[model samples]
Target: MFGGTDDAVIGFSGTGGQSLRQQFVANYAAKTPYLGLLGLSRSPTTISLPDGYSRSFSSTLAGAWYQGAQGYPASLTFGGYDALRGNTDSVLTLPLGAEITRDIVVQITAIGISSVGDPATPVQNVAAFIDSVVPEMWLPQEVCKVFKDAFDLEWNDDLGLYLVSDSQHEELLSQNATVSLSLESQGSTVTIDLPYEAFYQPITYPLADILDGTVLHYFPLRIAANDTQYMLGSVFLQEAYLAVDYHRREFYLSQAQFPGNENEYRIVTVHPPGWSHGLSTGAIVGIAVGAFALVVIACGLLWWFKYRPRSKKRASRLSAKSTEQDRDVFGYYGREKDGGEETYEKRELDTAEPGMRGSIASRCELPSPPLPQYSPGSPERDWPKDRGSIDMVEMGDYLTARRVPVQSPVELSADSEHERRPPPVEIA
Candidate 1:
């Protein structure tokens, strides 16, 4: 009879209660040394509710069995898996075998000791079933021999196990060998690496029948008589994670992570196809906050571009109007002439016609004292051609006699007669 939590019992009720029977056999035979079995099958148990409604229990099973002092605590998850217990990125998913006799069968392509400096044992299309009911791995005789030679293990005929002596255990520990098992199914391959510590299972009491109270550390490996007996038992699970989806007949295998005391529990739910379990409160709130933030940003942008202050635009328009008023009808940049406006003292050339070039010199001439005449060979007449105009030097001496500051000289060329006119002066 199946007895446990209602959910556990109900989950196995549909799968023929085979899990309970297996547990019974394992417990009686002492096959499972650590903990009892927990079935994670796809079977659904239907029960009638008080309101004449029926409910069915169906969920996925995911777990990891970690042993030894350095291993993490064992974890068994229903309806989901612990994300922290396995490397989710390296998980290998494969469909379950079609045979009714086999449940979680996979093809083990190769097995080797990575640190032993020896070639891998070629398994070659060997099908093996994974079970947690038994504690040791039942591999082919050739593979067992290879493992024995590599690990220096001794086969005990009385115990029917590969036992390791103290010296052998110490040597193996110092070597720190890692056993790699390559599994393939449905064209997908995954290799799981197990440290030497994973196989060093201690045998004691009823399991070993040791009367002297000596704990014998043995390598958990058995020789299979035929291919049909090939099995990777609980020892393999110590380093491999397993998840079963009975509804879809699919299973997954991944390298188990052992973080010891630093490990955290992170459960991720595995939902069935077409099943909907509405979003959590946290998720809903997060989405709502994100949507609200987007709306706020959009509104802020709309206000900035469409509804913000138009002071800059108004200022631009006013400046444009002022500019238009300042321009004459010809579009020249000057203020419009008005009556009674104070007119500035201007040179005679300011009123001259544009084409009246010949009259420019006479119009700009002021009634000043005449300059002293100089001989052809005199210093004044032969002054450097690079110097400023002669008129400017005489003006400077004149200004100095009157105690006025001399202004900067303006160079004038004889070829540019039209450019010699004085600038218009403003009246006081």
Candidate 2:
């Protein structure tokens, strides 16, 4: 049989059944949470029981099991689990409080093994590996001898394994034989005791070589021929919870617990190192939207400033040019007597005629005879032959006299008292 996680288990049956019929069986069980973190790193690893309770992984480091150069068993802290409260069997705990090292080495010293009623002794320092995939303990051939002698077991040369009678198996179960390990921590010694049940297993043989009329039974134990390595497999793990901390280079082993309810749980946040707080998706989206809106607003304001009309500037420039025209060409300072309000308003150029300034200067220098004032329906009088154009400002009493009524358009001389003076120009 091979079993660890439900996802990876295979079982086989051999020659023991009636008619020697062969069959293969497979099954799946609940999804084990710890199995999901296998071969993965930097994940929020956790494991929970049937109850709602859960325990999160304790570090920011990734949990990679059985797939790296530094593979370790999933172990809990040694004293983290509660004690076995109601069990009748005597259990032992050996605390291996070695300082954490870079390499997460999980080793326990197996001192010795014995059968029913035999006094357990300490073997030399024996290293063992904790592997859950292994069905049972794998002991060295020499260490297997100790168990064989203590139980008075027979060895079969053909099978190269120990053979236990049905009576011996029953007696061993009644006596509850044990194996021992010695751990040294801080100059003090701790011992771990394993009962006979921890090593019990059922073995099967192939059906191809069954003899006629011969009955065959299953044997569980197997010995390592080279005596070089010993393994503590799932049998031990079923009774213990192992937690490994790669960052701290340490591990803990405690007796497993089955909480009836999920109320009791410790939530741990396991994130990558240097990770504290980060912006959420909503916050990032909000900031992006705000930035885009601001950009659009800025572009609108820039376009308005660049292309909008400048009516005030055009008005000011036209007023300044009108004042310049009044000072340079017409030079008019006419007085008005209407409604007790004295007003002087400069008009813009009606026509842009060249040499008009010289003609006005010549007409102002000499006085001519006064012309007759005509009524609305009077016959037309003969006009003077010298000046061909009329002064639009002085036509029909439109331009008020400067405190004097002139008879003709040419009556206003350069030295005449009736000449109008230019109005004052307002700067700015």
Candidate 3:
């Protein structure tokens, strides 16, 4: 429970291994802490807890060590975890509300009947807390009275809530107005804007076996004592994110992101004493695979580009050599048949012109017959110099035969002398 209405102070003491127990719990997701303000000196009374090892408390948040007088501090020294809410964005900083101050105030800016937008009002400072246990806002009677006339709200004593008729609800939603809070600290003030839909609370009832479909649309604001300041409560926190640092004496608040919004999530881990930091197993594996894939792709591209030019140069050289050989042989080139036998193409030569015979025989390296000359006044044909013609001939039987060696007749000894001999012929 919050100490917004009256003065409340509690303390404990023990000695010789016997200690008093206290607890401090923090919910980072909800942005609230139980027993967070215990040691923070509140208004009308100062907050304290047991400090000795024998008389101490257990806590999830990091605790601070006090080095001063037994009860209160002459020169108070605090640490970061005294009211720590964990690390958050610095742009979310909000000014301190009137909690320990004498006046119970929850000042905020809202639209007036004669105003076009959020207008300045006399009630600009109100005491409020981002409470998790409560579901709605609880305001002082004076502030509620003003909202009643502005929103055209009807108070239902049976339901103990301010209800809006269907027509009024439509009119309020159509205005598209917002309630904003201004928190001041140092020399700057941060404003938090809450949309009108943040306060639409619907309630249902079940009568016997049947159900009454009466929907109670409300703004989630309750009337409290005049001295009691406003409570911002969970209704305000549902759409807001908050961070508090007691050691620095500062808090931060910003509008929360919706579920569908894209965001980068970075986990903030709190390390107790003796804990070390290192990379996780999954993260290490991901890095190794990514590096390997990049290396493989780069090597493949380099190899292909290096060999492409060399292949093209080799093909061009072979093509040029083939063209030269074809011209020297008079278009007669060997074409391999099956069983390794070579075949050649034959072309017939015509002897109608005088110069055609010499050109064809010279290019094919063959003997040429005599050509007839053209008579006077006859038309001469202009033949291209680069082209030549050759006559096909049967050369199988004209080819030279291979030579064979013969052995000479040998004379024997005395018995072989009887062999007859022929006389030599006289030269004429």
Best by lDDT: 1
Query: Which has the better TM-score: candidate 1, or candidate 2?
Result: 1
RMSD of 3: 21.7
- Candidate 2 residue-wise lDDT, 215-315, digit = tens: 43333346864434466656665445555444433444544443332123343333445555878899999999999999999988876786444656777
Residue-wise C-alpha lDDT for candidate 1, range 1-428, written one tens digit per residue: 23333223422234333232322221134433434334445454333357742333332232232343333445677888888887898878988887655678988888889667877777875788987766789988888888988888898999888999999898888888899999887788899998898788788776677666788988989998888888888778878989888777798999987654434578899888878688888999999999999999999998888766575688889999885664433244443355868443333344343323354433343334334424456555455544433343345213211112224546689897667765322221
Query: Could you give me the TM-score of model 3 versus the true structure?
Result: 0.38
Q: lDDT tens string, model 3, 278-309?
A: 77789889988989988988887876787756
Candidate 2 least-lDDT 10 residues: 8-17
Model with the higher lDDT, candidate 1 or 3: 1
C-alpha TM-score for every candidate: 0.51, 0.37, 0.38
Candidate 2 TM-score to native = 0.37
Pairs of colliding residues, candidate 1: none
Q: What is residue 171's positional error in candidate 1, in angstroms? A: 0.6
Runs of candidate 2 exceeding 4 Å displacement = 1-119, 184-190, 205-221, 225-228, 255-428
| Model 1 misplaced stretches (Cα beyond 4 Å) | 1-35, 43-71, 260-263, 277-428
lDDT of prediction 2: 0.46
